[model samples]
Target: MLLEVKNLNTYYGESHVLQDMALSVDEGELVALLGRNGMGKSTALKSIMGLVKPKSGTVRFKDKDIAGYPPYKVARAGIGYVPEERRIFPNLPVLDNLAIGIKGGKIDAGNPDAWTVDRVFKHFPALKARSGQKGSHLSGGEQQMLAIGRSLMGNPELIMVDEPTEGLAPFLVMEVRDMLKDINKVGVSILFVEHNLKVAMSLAHRLYLMGKACLAFTGTVEELDAQPEIRAKYLEV
Candidate 1:
């Protein structure tokens, strides 16, 4: 497995946000975490990335315990994260945004497939045109692309994205989905939180549904289709 979480629990002050959460993403796999709002879907990704420290459990990445490690440490272990908000510097140009994500020695010069700013621009042609544009000046979809591109600048083995398609136009949604698929094709494992069932079903090799602070179900897309009750109760609006 590229990443694994077992019995993870996290708290936000007085309230428990995640309870006994467990999930894993194998190499070259695209795993989706599905759920409605307030069920710890985003929190799960945050915990694994060490953005929010887990109160307990084990997070093993590439066969080493990473739970409770600082966010930078988790990132140094070759994991990247793109928040739902797409937190790019509004005043910074696209190239500068991409440049800051570089982790000194992370990019292996010997690896032909390793990521670089030009590679990112090639993957996101729209971003290429806007390479000199300020982040706030780009459209929502472009910002999302920038966020993903910035993470790629880290040359991570796996990436965790939160609510990637929320509030996007249908075309933009498809664009984001295609970008993710292309990234996966290049051998980056992905663990993404998405509320859109159609996107999850169409994109993932496996799915984990969160409900009431824990994982309620996990299976293939066909298996999810086989259990409509689980979908209606946990996924449907």
Candidate 2:
């Protein structure tokens, strides 16, 4: 497994947010974490990336235990995270924003590639066209694209994305989804937390439903698609 999270528990002050959450991802796979709002899906991603310190559990990446490491250490260990809010440097130019996120390392060019600025530009041409523009000047979709592109510059083996498709037009959502598919095609494993079932089903090979701060069910996308009752019980508003 490229990423393995086991029996993870996290808290925010007095509230327990993630309870015994566990999941795994292999190389080149796109896995979805699904649930309604306030189910700890984003917390799980934060815990893995070391933004939220877990009370207990193991987070193993590439066979190294990184349970309580800092966020910078996690990034250095080859994990890239795109938070739910598209957090880009608003004052910085597009190219500078991407350049700041770059971490120097050996990139695999032959297969399962690592991203360069050129490759990132190819994936998001709008960013290329607006390389000189400030991040605050871009559209919502463009900011989202820049967010993903910034993460890619780190050359991570795994990317954990939270709510990549939220608050976008249908056309922009489709474009971002396709961009994620293209990135996954090159063998980078993805752990995505998403509320959009249609997008999750279309993109993920495996599905994990979260509820009450724990994983309720996990299986292939086909299995999840067949369980309408599960959807209505846990996912429907």
Candidate 3:
């Protein structure tokens, strides 16, 4: 497994956010974590990335236990995280934003398949064209693209993206979906958190459904298609 979480429990102040949550992603697999808002999907990713300190759980990445490590440690261990908010430096140009994510100030010498600015631009041509534009000047889709591109510059083996196509137009949503597919095709594993069922069903190799802070279903896309009741109960609102 590239990533694993077992018996995970997390809290926010006094509020219980996750309970016995568990999931795994294999090498090079694109796994979708699906749920309505506040169902612990984002929390699960945060816990895995060490952005949230889980009260008790095992976040095992590459077979090493990394449950309580800090966020930087997690990133250096080859896990990239593109957060839900699309947090980019508002004043920084597109190229500069990408530059900030270069892991360890340079790609790991041990891993030659690392990404660079030119490589990132190749993947996101829109960003290349707007390299001189400040982050705040781009459209929503462009900002989302920059976020993913920036994460790629970190040379992570596995990338976790939250809400990649949340509020984009239909065309832009399709573009983002295809972009993710291409990213996966080039030997990067992806853990995606998405609300769009159409997008998830089309791209995911496997699916996990969350409800009330616990896993409700886990299977392939084909299996998910057969469980309309599960979808209606937890996903369709």
Candidate achieving the largest lDDT: 3
TM-score of 2: 0.95
Candidate 1 vs candidate 2: the TM-score winner is: 1
**Compared with the true structure, what per-residue lDDT tens digits does model 3 show for residues 1-237?**
989889999999998999999999999999999998889999999999999999998999998999999999999999999999999999999988998899778766686677988888888888889999999999999999999999999988999999999999999999999999999999899999999999999999999999898999999999999989999998964
TM-score for each candidate, following the candidate numbering:
0.97, 0.95, 0.97
Q: Rank the candidates by lDDT, best first.
A: 3, 1, 2
lDDT of 2 at 131: 92
Clashing pairs in 2: none
Instruction: Give the runs in model 2 whose Cα sits over 4 Å from its true position.
Output: 104-113
lDDT of 1 at 42: 83
Model 2 / residue 209 / CA error / Å? 0.6
Q: How well is each residue in 156-222 modelled by candidate 2, as lDDT tens digits?
A: 8899999999999999999999999998997678999888899999999999999798988899988
Model 1 misplacement above 4 A = 105-107
